[model samples]
Target: MATIKAIVEKSALAGPRSIKISDEATFSLPAGDVFLPAEAAARVMQAYGQAVNEKVLVGMVFPARDEGGWGAVLSFAKEGYVRDDDAQNWKADDLLHRMRVLQAQSNPVRKSHGVPELDVEGWAQPPTYDTTMHRVMWATISHKQGEPDDDAHRYVNYETVALGRDGHLLLGVASHLAAFNQSKIIADGLLADIDFDNGKHYADFDKTTDHVAEYGLAALVVGVAAKKLGLLAVFLAFVAKFAKIGVALPFAAAAIRRRFKKRVPARPVAAVTTDRQEPR
Candidate 1:
């Protein structure tokens, strides 16, 4: 088994928010406050991956090395209250299904562009980090082609959703597809180490004063209320588009030559001159 070292730091999000991450990875912060308004947050997130309509409180990317190929990225977003219907019976499987559907829709687009699609090979909900505070869900994706050869070559993503005491919904997503099992350990550790100020945790919810959300846990996964795609879809689409272009350009050039042959006009031959008087 591998050992991990934890470092607690001020969250890139707003006040009273802090996070913990493994010391092995280097963290990158957005230029400004990550908790920008919905539109601003969406734009900022796009710079990292894709536009997410939700109000992002903070976004951080942990690159395994200074050179940046693979590592872990995390984001915290705010959703309105949880709906009564969904809160009662929502399960991690529901989120997994939603993710699968999104993958199916996005995969073909990626392949068409020549980028390999990541397949969701497995998923499971580990024991909750804090049963009274949040519900956790996780899934693993197939490794990208050409990734470093390693025993733990796989991609894993985790989402922790909780209802804040103020009747607000909070979501935390950790995406790690490159650093093998190292990222997995980091993600789990981060969740376990999360510390929210008083009146912020789910256990602080007040039934009398707090308002109920129109949607529930299911809504968080499927976005029933917003009826819009989540950040994962947007991020995947962005990656596919760029990856396909990079991967296909060379092959596309070759294919183009086969389809349309450009005839180079034959150059006129220069008259030949002989050093001897041409034997005339």
Candidate 2:
């Protein structure tokens, strides 16, 4: 659809560019990547789901030969400094159950919007927190209800959280099931590219003065599965995989007024590319 192209066109950067990830960190996006600022990034998110209050930034499109490019969205949650002591006792089985409950609760809203309900089948990659990097990344394999659990209809929601003294940077990488592993490598690389400012590092959290998020890292996972980013992820899953085969994504949000009907052909959206070719 021209809709997808028009929204995504005109924003490709000839990078090695520095992007401000909220007010907390700097993202050194590799060369030839597109960077969508917070406001522009939020508009893209709103197109797929409900209104969002989170600070959105760094939308990059990776070209995939001819299948069209898949991309990722970055959001920042300033929920104060999050304490990660629970990582030692993290129980992913329990966390997965909680995510499923949240998904069920959101099904009604999904149905109302003409979006098919999707269930969390399981982790494409289990939740892992890096003690040294102070970041967490996970991926969920979700499929449309009643559909066979196959890559053709599978949606991989790969998410990464980079903790900071003030809050955390959220990266939700959307990709086709077949592209999950490659996308994970890219997401991990992007995570490594982020850096906190002088005093904003997670190590700089001062229990005496800094704010601590009421919820732990586990709660962050559950909240993301049911809220703003969750809805965006679902639509993106459709946009990423369905669009690969040229199916038109339904645009149904009252929040989106600028319409695009043009479909941008897929191109290489890898983190770095020497060539600066536009999408076909």
Candidate 3:
């Protein structure tokens, strides 16, 4: 098994409210509280972009390929993670190893089979990266809030595409989803599959206890969009209309009359009013 080691440090540009997840480390920090190593952060963000792109592509209005490519990728990823040998069949792990060997051997003849590289630009964190990191962080919060089994939702590592010549990873731009469907992660750690090695497995390993953090940041984005759309619709619908107390007064009065009826006597209401006005 190829071991992956990753480390996270602190960055001034990354705010205290900033959260980051990478192939090496997952970060949840207050401004200036923590920093993640640049490479690992880029790798994680890249993978995250790919993952989000996959979800979006599968759900696209006009999908590129109709031959169950999404299912094929998922099955392939799962198989590589579990399988042991090539005689049994081919797998992602096998491919990853072969690629690593090619990288190590420096065979320009087989350059096409080498490992993929990632390039992240300055900003623009993708929703998946944010969501995955928040999930881990919130899972921790939920644990603190006394939720059980909240630690089984963590993500260790994932696969993502390499940026172009600039080596920039832009979470905001639409990427080629077909590429992601072909890429795969070497290995991953899920919250449900937590087995602490302290320092035995990879470089970024830590002794901290795991937790399940659920962050519905995407829902928040959707909520904000819905609210904005609603506000825009209302504004457009009522645009160019003159403000009038004439229209507002009747509606306000009706509301007040309803409140008054709730407090008035149910029976003989007219008689009570007549008696009150009986020259008293």
Candidate 4:
């Protein structure tokens, strides 16, 4: 089992923050103050390819041996705070509601691939890591281009919203479905691992000493970050590639065997002579 360790820098936050993921391999970000699992990073790089730019703040990939793997990404607003207007009615549920609408309207992969609208299975504002974190669990059936109707893939996604003590917005998402029931387990593990520096937790907020966030927690979910980052598109792309492997693995195995056989030359057999005739 591998683990991911993210040491959040004091510069990135008004306070210190850190997180560690168990059973996953971690990778450091080029920008510093951020980290992600190596597998998730690879998937993000593969999905975005050359299009990936500095706009991507932090990305994580969770590759489950089972069917429930997913990817997560976090990006900061230029202002580094949620907008003032949106912060007024800030609530996790509202942000989630707005996100669903945005996905229905603007997700490029869903629009082009004709993936069905996201169905909300459940949601909650759970208290974990000594901070209140909002979690949304949803499901969707995505149709592959040219695939039979029955071949639609069922996907489950769990999105989490939290505000760092320093007023930084953080989003964590884990996607899986019926075939991948352990998504929640993985998501919870991640949430529990978060450790805010002595003065950087939500509980440590000080209006006098600490800077206040311009936007509310709600803005973190509904803001342009999701749109600009293209979270759903990146996630779906990962799923497509994951599914593609299932289909291609057998062919790939066969090709490997063929190549192996071709690479090894046949051993020459030397003639064997019988020496028993002298005894007779």
Report lDDT (CA) for all predictions: 0.38, 0.63, 0.20, 0.38
Relative to the true structure, candidate 2 reaches a TM of 0.76
Q: Pick the candidate with the highest lDDT.
A: 2
**So what's the TM-score on candidate 4?**
0.49
lDDT of candidate model 2 versus the reference: 0.63
Superposed Cα deviation of residue 155, candidate 4 (Å): 2.9
Give per-model TM-scores. 0.49, 0.76, 0.15, 0.49
Candidate 1: regions farther than 4 A off = 1-49, 63-76, 83-95, 106-118, 124-130, 142-153, 167-180, 221-280
lDDT of 1 by residue, 174-269 (tens): 334443244344344344444555556666556787666555555565442112223333333333343333321113334323322322312222
Task: State, as a TM-score between 0 and 1, how close model 1 is to the true structure.
Answer: 0.49
Q: Model 3, range 1-280, lDDT digits (tens) per residue?
A: 0111122112112323323222222222222111233343333333322222222121111011111111111100100011111212222233233333433343232234332222111111121222111111100000111223322311111222111111111111111222221211101111211121223222222326322122222222222222111111111111112121112111233442342233321111111000111110
Higher-scoring candidate on TM-score, 1 or 2? 2
Best by TM-score: 2
* Better lDDT candidate (2, 4): 2
User: Model 2 over residues 1-280: C-alpha lDDT tens digits?
Assistant: 4554555454434345687765678888754344555555566556666556644444543332223234667777787998887776767667777888888887888778766787877777667777777777777777778777667777777787889999988877777688776667666666666788889999998989999999997788667755532543534553565345442232322211111112221222222111222111
